[model samples]
Structure formats: structure tokens, C-alpha cells
Target: MTMSDDIVRMARAWIGTPYQHQASVKGVACDCLGLIRGIWRERHGTEPETPPPYTADWGEGGGQEVLMTAALCHLMPIDRQTPMEPGEVLLFRMRPGAVAKHLGILSAAGQAPRFIHAYNAHGVIDSPLTTPWQSRIAARFHFP
Candidate 1:
């Protein structure tokens, strides 16, 4: 299968996985970052680097773009203006002045684009990439 297809497939497999901070095993639990980390491990044997623990609020207001920096270091950068497609990594800023911290993997694209993420109360699920979600996207990337 194509890499994009593989990524979507793997992400789908994590559907129903409970959201748990710092966890990464599929079907058990994972946070948004953990979901990305798990998929990376599926394609690459080792993680580029281990992440330090993050708080429930995602360490917001820290004045540091931690997530963006990490994505730049590992994933291939994609212009935020570029249309999103399956397998693309999405980094979001929860609020206007807050640090960009959320992450998701595009699962579908076109008229009704969708993404997979380990949401706090929703677990790992594919959801529509609605306007609000689109607006919060601070950057995009793809597996290196």
C-alpha cells in the first residue's frame, strides 16, 4: 500500500484507544502526541527522541512553540497554506496567544476532510476537519 494509505490505516487501527497522557501503545491508550509517536514507530523502528512529560493543559502559556519545534526537527515541514491530505501532521494552537500544542494526522481529504487524534474526552477518533479546527492549525508536516 502507499505510505499515505498505510498511515491512514494505522491511525484507523487506533480508533477507540483511550486517551492517556504519555502512553503510546495502540488499543491501550495514547495522547495526541502519543498517537503520532506510535505511527512513527510503526514505520520507523526507533523514535528520533523521547519526549518529556507534558501537563494536562499541554504546558500552554509556556511561551515556547514546543510542538512546532519538535515537528520541524523530525517531520518534513509543509507550508500551512498547502491543502491538507491524508497522513499529514497538523499542529494546532488551542488559543490565539497560547503555544501551539495539539496534533492530529489527516485521515481523509476533499470536500469533507477528516483527521485522527486522541482527544481528551473523545479518545482516538476520526472527526471532520471543520472550519474552527482548520483555523487553529498553526503548521503542517509529514513523515520525514
Candidate 2:
């Protein structure tokens, strides 16, 4: 199977995981970043480094693009203007003037694009890439 297919399959495997801050155990609990971290481990063996402890308000308080920075360091950066493809990582700015913190993996692309993310209160789910969500996309990357 293609790498993108592999990514989608692996991400789907965690669909039932509950949302838990800073956790990454499949089918048990994980946060958005944790979902990505778990997929990275599945595809690449081991994580390059462990993330530092962070709070829900971590990004807003720091004013730093920590998520984007980490993605740049480890993943293959894609131009923001580029069209998204399945299996690619998506970096979202939750609000204007805020650090790009939320993350999701593009699961389907085309007329009705979809992305999978560990969302608070909803757990891991494949959400449609609606206009509002698409507008929040700040950067994109691919697993390297």
C-alpha cells in the first residue's frame, strides 16, 4: 500500500480513542498532538523526541508557533497555498492572532475533503473540511 493509505489506515485505527490531555494510547486516550505522535511512531518506529508538558492554553500564552516549528523540524513542510492531500498533516490556527496549535491528518481530499483529529469531547473523529475549518489552516506537512 501507498504511504498515504498506510497513514489513513493507521489514523482510522484510533477512531475510538477518547480525548485525554497529553495522552497517546490508542483506543484509550489521546489529544490532537498525541494522535499525530502515535501515527508517527507507527510509521517511523520511534519519536524523535518527547514533547514538553503543555496545558490547554499553552499556545495562547506563549505566542509561539510551537506546533508549526515542530512540524518544520520533523515533517516535510508544504507550502500553505498548496492543495491538501490525504495523509498530510494540517496545522490550524484556532483563532486570529493565536499560535497555530491544533493538528489533524487529512484523510480524504477532493470535493468533500475530510480530516481526522482527536477533538475534545468528541475523541478521534473524521471531520469534514468545511469552509470555516479550511480557513483556519495555516500550514501543511507530510511525514518524513
Give the candidate number with the greatest TM-score: 2
User: How many clashes does each candidate structure show, in the order listed?
Assistant: 0, 0
Worst 10 residues of 2 by lDDT: 56-65
Candidate 2 lDDT over residue span 29-105, tens digit each: 99999999999999889999999998876578869778888889999989877877899999999888888889999
Stretches of candidate 2 above 4 Å error? Answer: none
Best by lDDT: 2
Per residue, candidate 1 scores C-alpha lDDT tens digits across 49-105 of 999977867667568777888999999988767777899989999888888888999
Please report the TM-score between candidate 1 and the true structure: 0.95
Cand. 1 Cα-lDDT: 0.90
